[model samples]
Target: MVFRFAKTLDPITLFHAPSLQTSTNALNILKAASAAATAGTVTSNRGEFQLEITTAPPTTDQLRNIIDYVTANPAGAGSNKTDYAVGEVIKGAKDAEDAVKRFKEGGEGTFIRPITVDWTNGKAVLGDNESEILKMVHQLEAN
Candidate 1:
């Protein structure tokens, strides 16, 4: 009489290191975008501005940090101004700078610059400023 034995096998496991890297890159991009939006508020005489992160949609704590920084460091008015109009311009400049820094720091892969100011009316009105921001983001991403 002859006897036969059965064999057992285990399946292969896969890891998502690349996906994690991509996610990290995306988060970095968002952070950069927030910074860029804030940086866009810088002016010559007037100081930088801040934004209300709670009102803005899809903004993270990192972005809110920029706004908070500006609010804490108001120019002439010490956070008691009613209009907050000038602050808006400063905020925009700061936001742009932040985005640019992120792009240069290797956040071009998973982010896009926004195409609109976060205020109703302002003096630093540059046409297609949003497009300009997007262009910077795309440039970084392409690299």
Candidate 2:
């Protein structure tokens, strides 16, 4: 057997892939950590933590939110094709990036059409709030 080096786990700053209410353990850990935290316990008197979300690595939920936003808020009179592309993403359940690309490539142009994506190749990860996703999608709609 060979020796392997491992670092100590940091409970206070846990970083788990965000999901749609899927990470119960992470929630538990946060709750426990917050409860245990006290003055000077974790550099802050209050149990405050910072969360960041990025679009480079979006999640399935984000994809859904984008579709929902596009559906609810139609961009323009000729945005039917764009809307349909969003539908294809949901029906196909494509990965977040793939879905975004589908909408971009298939939407707008009269000859454009949504394409199929191999769902097996998808490896989506969660970001922050769904509203953040809506903003990104809104930009797509404008284009």
Candidate 2 structure quality by residue, lDDT tens digits, 48-111: 3222222132244544454443342345665322233443434343444566665455543211
- Number of clashes in every candidate structure? 26, 0
Q: Candidate 2, which segments miss by more than 4 Å at Cα?
A: 1-22, 43-47, 50-96, 99-143
Quick one: best TM-score, which candidate?
2
Question: What tens-digit string does per-residue lDDT give for candidate 1 at 16-101?
Answer: 12334432443344345545544763222222223221212223443333234323334654432222222342332345456445
Cα RMSD of all models vs. native, in order, equals 21.7, 16.3
> Global CA lDDT of candidate 1, please?
0.31
Worst 10 residues of 1 by lDDT: 8-17
Point out the worst 10-residue segment of candidate 2 by lDDT: 110-119
**Whole-model lDDT, candidate 2?**
0.33
Model number with the top lDDT: 2
